[model samples]
Target: MAEMVGIAFAFSYIGDAFHGSQIQPEVRTVQKDLQIAFHKAKFAGSNPLLRFSSRTDAGVTARMNVAVCVVKKSVWQKMGDLRFRRALNDHLKDVVVWAAEETSEDWNPRMASRRVYRFRLETMRQFNKPHDEGKLLEMMKLFEGTHDFTGYCRPEEGRITTRTVDYCKPWSIDGRLVGFEIAAQSFLWNQVRRIAWAMSEVALGTSSIEVIQEALGKGEQPPFFGLGPSKWLTLWAIEYEDISFTDKSGDFFENLSAPPVGINGRQFEIWQQSADHEQKQLLLNSWLSYL
Candidate 1:
């Protein structure tokens, strides 16, 4: 039996173009693109065992995500990390492979130390205002400890809804209710968005804090507050202990950064500029309704 090498890469993707991170038949996804790239590179057998640290839904962007794959040692040494990244990028569109490193075969991205997510809510509407910072902070605190998050997530058959949330809090950025940041080891499906929806209702005075408490205390699902729009949410970061990623040039990254080594950094800058321009135009269009 030939020895295998574990290859891990840090990647980012603009979610608008992808159906989701997971693979589905006849659907475009991050995983599907990556698998195709692997096949093209001849790095793995017909069916590669590619694994991702987090599964993002449609329209949910990610600043940093980790993926791990195992390939024959001979193949890795021959192609090298940098060349491998370049080959992968050649086949990817919205996804960028920024850094790579060697890892143990037993490593699993899902067992991450911490996972942080950000949910942004515009303050233009009454529902987005925080009625009382102190009171809202208190409500956010209720989610800090271990609790059955049955109310905050969609029910999955034979899956436990109980999970520990290390931190959950609302923060304002430049006087706007930017959104809430939540960190946990793992989360239930739609958990963060649903929590944000319930919190927004409380802030808007449409729902009471006691109602949230009742759901938390009773471990029961609350009436649908409505899942926040996926576009406003992002998987901000995933943390692992003592693992570092480096580019093919042997340049080590102190932290997970954007525009990975094989990618054209200027392209991302231009994309952001175009996105900002479009956003401003949309805001102006909305204002025209008032006139």
Candidate 2:
């Protein structure tokens, strides 16, 4: 049996590099490039094969994404020892495979571990205005532990609604919008997007905690269809206890210096000014509609 190799990438290469995460006949994709590189490198002097854990949308991103491939240990060492970042950039710069890690013949990226994601939202409209960060935190507290997130996500990551969410809560990010982190064994497609929309509604007082709580069920009349664009959700990390994220996923600036707080403030103000004055009045009155 051929040995399996696990690969990881940053999500920034979505629509620009390929059509999306999914591999299609007419377009380029992350997985395709990896396989292409392997073949081009003649890692085994044969066509290279690879697989991704989850297929992301056109614009989606990953901080610690994962992919798997198989090759002989000799070829694995040759490719693994190669300076992947410079090599890939020099030869196959189109798709930046900055890192690579070797795994046993039986390794599986998706089934062996959990995933972590971080999402940030900037209140760009009300740049300098103060937000009730405490209220946002309080509402997010409601997401902790196991709960039905069916209302907030698309039905593609998985069909089962009973997910044991290890972490769900919001924290301040720069003075703009709240940032939330989620860690779980896995996720369904668009799950984070749908949750972000619901959480944002709650923050703006447009929806209640009960609305989110009530929507957790997978029964008839599930949660609201996802809101907002899919650009904001970033797959921050993928885990497989069996495989060391560091060894398999490669280096992710996990310890970067603090982000620009000023940029967030400016973006927040911009987002606020973009809001309609009349619409604000209607939103104020319709606040009760969330009930």
Candidate 3:
């Protein structure tokens, strides 16, 4: 037995391709697929445990997510980091492992320094109500700093609903409102999505900014803001305090083709479904290039 070594790999995937990042029975997931690829590539040791840095929901894309896998030390040293990445990528589909490096055996992926998320309102049909950049910015600033996000998240039992948002701002491109970005050391479930719903409502005149203000105000009762669709959300990055991963994604992005095309209206419903998926890929690739 060649001792075991832990290697952390940074990867990205189209959210719609799998049920979610965690492993689940029957349905496919990012973790499950990665495990299968590891088996195929012989990258894992006996009963290896793989863990992800962040858990993203179904239909939510990730530009970068970290996961640690335990592999035989000799195998790792012989194959090296870049080759290890290729081994995984060669056996995976949709999910791309772009970077990898050796890390401490007990490395905890969840203890990240900061996690950044982005929600693209323009890509969501429900937020079609007219909105302007100025209004979006104004609505976004209210979320900055510490606030009780009770009304802005789907609370987990026994977990405190109060959380501090490091920063919140409108993410724009070419002078157009793309969506919003928010960062924190950690977040409650659906916190960013709920916040996006509130900001869009206020900017589009569906609700007043005061609704959000009241939600954050201490000792004040908050109202529930609707949850935004997961499809428009993306886990942009996860920063660590002590670990750094080298870029091993040479030509990976360059080799990616443009978004898939959708058929025109022969079967209106099918065409619309195809078009929706196409739009998501387009937006996802756009953000990927920006990274």
Error of 2 at 52 (Å): 1.6
User: Residue by residue across 200-247, what tens digits does model 3's lDDT show?
Assistant: 677777777777687678624356458788877888888887876524
**Clashing residue pairs in candidate 1, if any?**
98-260
Error of 1 at 194 (Å): 0.1
Q: lDDT (0-100) at residue 242 of candidate 3?
A: 81
Candidate 2's error at 156, in angstroms? 4.2
Best TM-score among the predictions, by candidate number: 3
The runs of at least 3 residues in candidate 3 whose Cα sits more than 4 Å from the true structure, single-residue gaps closed, are 219-224, 246-291
- What C-alpha lDDT values do all the predictions have? 0.72, 0.55, 0.74
> Could you tell me every candidate's TM-score relative to the true structure?
0.79, 0.72, 0.84
Full-model lDDT, candidate 1: 0.72
Model 2, residue 123: C-alpha shift (Å): 5.7
lDDT of 2 by residue, 1-291 (tens): 655444433222433345667667978776666666666666544575566776676655554566766667765566553454444444453344535566665566667467777665443222133345666677666666776655655665547765677887664434434467887887766777666766666666666777666666433223456454544455666666655554434323232223335556656445444432322333233222211
Order of candidate numbers by lDDT, starting with the best:
3, 1, 2
Q: Rank by TM-score, descending?
A: 3, 1, 2
The C-alpha RMSD in Å for every predicted model, in order, reads: 10.2, 10.5, 5.1
Q: Candidates 2 and 3: which is better by lDDT?
A: 3
